[model samples]
Target: MLKNKNIILGVCGSIAAYKSAFLVRLLVKAGANIKVILTPDGANFITPLTLATLSKNPVYTQYFDEETGVWSNHVELGLWADLILIAPISANTLAKLATGICDNLLTAVYLSAKCPVYVAPAMDLDMWKHETTQTNIHQIQSFGNLIIEPGDGELASGLYGAGRMAEPEEIISFLDHAIKHSMPLYGKKVMVTAGPTYEAIDPVRFIGNHSSGKMGFALADELARLGASVTLIAGPTAQKENQILTRIDILSAQEMLNACTSIFSEMDITIMCAAVADYRPKVIANQKIKKQADSLVLELEKTVDILATLGKSKKANQILVGFALETHDEENYAKGKLAQKNLDMVVLNSLNDKGAGFKSDTNKITIFNKALECTVFEMKSKTAVAKDICTAILKILK
Candidate 1:
């Protein structure tokens, strides 16, 4: 869940400050972009050089560097992070945080942060049980900060009690669960179809479109980003995804239909985005046809409509979306498909418009909802287009 996330790791003064190094390494290994902010006292427990090397970013100790004359913009740092985590938070820092103290860069960044803040407290058993410290923790929580409760174990004070910082692995798992549950599409299951399905006529001959599966891949990635469990069913294509998702590969339209129908009933949302072959050769030659004839004639038959088949079985709670790639009368045709196929929405694309067709990175789309409400968008990169489409879907979900 932390993949590609911008995270600020705050290390405060505590013997547990040493564990921040392991946390930084784990976060980086999980594909997070890490920036370490070390308190002055934290530096005594763990050197800035050690964290800098582990995080692969320059560690921030003070707000300003006297020798280099460079200033670290606390507000910018705060805004850049998706989340801020304070590990090994000391009683002193906890008190400072609850009272809005901004004496250090870490506190200043916390105050300026617009994103979620998480803290893992580490102190002696007496300090953890102290009334003042508990009050401070309550105040911080009242302000919307989350606390990863300290564990029960031996502390630096040589007394065993509930004051040990959470282990690095535990902290990571906590963050992942917290972040995943907070997402808008959490627990939703989505299915997307992409690319062009090929219809085989002979061993060496087949028919397929020029779809690159860029838009479909982008949509799957976007849905996954929103925390939806996405299964991408793709036709023959070289397209790849950045996010990890369940992917099923197929070549023919029949294969695509079988795949979609087998799982369509279980999907909360199904997007039919593949450019499937409308017609296929009626007869398939067992072996390659020899070039012995001057001309050849092949009869064609309509391929099974995967979208309509799924639409027939779609539950009222399930959303079914289809795409219409047209050369003319795009809006009417898209609206027709939306109603005729029992689709919740139809995304229209016009091949007549430059940069809006198969194999292109850019596209112009017009979305028609079940109510026939139309939303037209300008030509944009497929990635941005995917976001727009996902936003529309979210409105319906809401």
Candidate 2:
């Protein structure tokens, strides 16, 4: 997505400045034309020569060069960029950005830039948690600047917490998503369901499947980054936010149905990304059932069929996508479901394929459409897979 794009990378003072070198490398490898702007304090952590060498361009460190009597035009630099990424954005720099303090070249260019601006904050855990820092963060976000959240781990100060900058690879992924915001679906409303439904059997036990919810959450973030207002009906899982998400929590298959049914009509697109249970125990024990010598016999009943229900009520222009995670005869099963459930498209994932199912970060998908056409994708990160899925949706929209 960064192909042939002009990228301005702003480095700020922090121990994480060293990661900027890797970030530059990643951007360059992704085909972005690079420009580097280094704050004076950032020079303390990483040398201008180092960034210059990696970027294959002169690193702009000051407003004017004293010996050469030449000025670096912040306005021209700003206008040249397709996106400006500020890594290791300290609390001080963030505050300046929030309040329009253009005391330095980086800040000046940020103020002048018309392109999308993204900040990856790096600071001490305490500073990140402080009210002032949070306010600055919120202020920047309110202005539509993307704030890639810092991760949690050991900090330079030897205090372990959530102040470390996200990895270079993660930053590149977000940048790619941010750059693809021109699609019409960018501001459309997309509703999705993901993960496995847990049918309660007792206080201590429940019946559930091995659904990671990775594909659904990935699709949600991908759609959001494309400018879609996404509402994710997520089942029980440990998934974290890859982008801003309006997550509606659900437990059982019935609850999942209730959530999706409530919002399905208002959505422009609905992707049934969940692995909802087919059945639940007829009777859920109020307390944990003790271990017994005798074999137990519990009754089961059908759970609500969310996708089919939505399809029955779907509007003419609304797109409804479904997923079929199958163990056998995947293509046949998926195509049948596509017809039966009235899905515009069905993504089929075969557990038979290594690394293509449940709980893994990677997945291979075969999209079977109503037109009787199918497209298969190679195993990739759920994030990239999401891009392909969104591309398919866009094709239908067109």
Candidate 3:
């Protein structure tokens, strides 16, 4: 994925600066065009000539050439690169970068760059744990820089703690993951259904499930994070999402169905996560029934199956995902529903799993495809589970 891509490696003044040489070698081996920029004090740890020899390019260290008196343009360097990486970022450098203090060419390029910036911090354990440093880290993230979290190990201070910079191989893996996640679903329209749909018995009474809408809302947020314009059709639930999703709130299963059907043609993908009631009162009482009878018996009828309806009419390019919440014969029931509905994928959750049911913040699921290929995941927070689902969906789309 890094082949022929422009990459800038920023080296700071720290003992971990020695690792930057390996970082440069790995990136070059992956067929990336490399530009090395060193802080003035950084050369004291590792020579610029050595990095220049490996990168096959001149190492940038100053604002101007000492021999020719020609000035170096940080703006041009910033615009030339597709990605900028600051490895072994010192505590002082991090604070300066976070505060927009550009005293060196690397910091100046950071201020001018339009591409994504990645930082790998290396400092003493005390400095890493400082409150002020933590605040500055948050500030840098708020400014849109991605932080590659430091690992815990023996620091340069000869103390074992959480201050070591990530190794070269792990850094490359992080970059690869980031590239895959960057606007992956751009230009795609998605619709997600969430919450338990109420089936009315009367004006005041209704039949509903214990769905809290956490799973569906999390899925919507994950899709939106991947650059999809998500339309969230929600049933009556006490859940709220902070992302700017196009949310349409409804009461009953039929209302939810109407909303989804109206937008079904425009969506590229649909995720049916809502726990909709299968039946409703055949005749709703205009008012609450008086408590005159010993028992109550009301006629019932089947409600519209939203997922099956979408599956039946889905276009060749449209992808439909169905969720199966099962109690008994979980795998067979989930597989049966997937094939019967003609869905592209089925996400199965069993009430048998302790933390995998409705109203909980966590879930465990197994995904099955038309080929009957399945992937089972351990119980995790709903956010993590949503990420798994999104990754699977993207693989199918590819």
Candidate 4:
């Protein structure tokens, strides 16, 4: 997707700077023509030679090359780029950018660049969570720079939190979306639901499914990359927030229905990706159910039909999508659900397909539109799955 694209990779001071080498290599391997700009502080972690070799372009470290006496013109570099990306952006550099301090060539070029600017911040947990850092992040956004949010994990400081930069593969995908602005779904609003609903059986015990939420999260990220404002209404899951989401948390099927009902009217599109339980326990136990009997029978009540309700109220400008996971007669069941729910499109996945279902990281989807036409995609990473779904949504929007 990055084939022959002009990219400026701005490296800032952070322990995560070492990952920039792999990032550069990945970008080059994907056919990007990359130029690297290293902050003086960043040189301490990774040498300019290492990155220059990987990117196949001379690294820019200063305003002028001391040996050649030729200046690195910030204006020209800025104009030359299709995209300006700052990976492992240190808190210090972020502050500098937020304040418009153009003391270095990179910052100067950033100020002059007409191309889109993307930031990937990396720092200690404390630094990342600090009010100052958050303010700087909002400032950068207000200036029109897209933030590729740091991931949560063990930091160099030995503290576990969200301070690590996104991996190279993720960044590459992000760049792909930024570069392709002509997608049909651009400037649309999309709503997605993902993960398993937890029906409260007690204060601790709850009825939940094995849903991983990967499909919905993928769809949300992909739609956002295509330039849509995505509101991801997610159920309980151990998922990380990505650069593409405006997330809303929910618990039981009732909550999921509530979340959908409140937001569906305003959306340009909605994809019901959640594995909401069809029924909920009629009686709530104040405490955990005791083992008084060898067998337990609990009454179950039907949960609200989020998809059908939305379909009934759907506006002419809005597009509604649904998902059908079947174990038998997959196509017949999926098509029936699609027609019954009034969905513009439906994605079907059978449990029989290994490595492509709940609790897994990958998926193989067959998309069915209102016309009953089908588009089948091979097994792909959730991120790639997102692109396909976004493509389908774009077709609907067009």
RMSD of each: 1.0, 14.1, 17.7, 14.5
* TM-score (all chains, Cα) for each model: 0.98, 0.61, 0.60, 0.61
Instruction: Give the clashing pairs for model 4.
Output: none
The segments of candidate 1 whose C-alpha lies over 4 angstroms from its true place after superposition are none
Evaluated at residue 95, the lDDT of candidate 4 is 94
Q: Candidate 3, which ten residues in sequence have the lowest lDDT sum?
A: 175-184
Per-residue lDDT tens digits of candidate 1, residues 1-398? 99999999999999999899999999999999999999999999999999999999999999999999999999999999999999989999999999998999999999999999999999999999999999999999999999999999988989999999999999999999999999888899999999999998899989888999999999999999999999999998898998879999999999998898888888999988889999999999999988998999989999998888888888899999999999987788998998889999999999999999899999999999999999999999999999999999999999
Cα lDDT of model 2 by residue, 124-225, tens digit: 999999999999999999999999999999999999999999999999998867665664676689998889999999988899999989999999988876
- On the 0 to 100 scale, the lDDT of residue 154 in model 2 is 96
lDDT of all the models against the reference? Answer: 0.95, 0.91, 0.92, 0.89
lDDT of 4 by residue, 1-398 (tens): 46666999999989899999999999899878999999999999999999999998899999988899999999999999988999989999999999999899889999989998999999999999999999999999998899998899999989999999999888888877766665556667889999999998877788889998988887887776566778999999888656556899999999889888998888999999899999899988899888799898888898898999999998888899999998889999889988898889999998998988898889888999999999999998878877887778778866
**lDDT per residue (tens digit) for residues 147-263 in model 3:** 999999998789999989999999999986786567789779999999999888888899889999999999998898777889999998898975667999999999999999999
**Whole-model alpha-carbon lDDT for candidate 3:** 0.92
Ranking under TM-score, best-scoring first? 1, 2, 4, 3
Q: How far does residue 126 in candidate 2 sit from its true spot (Å)?
A: 50
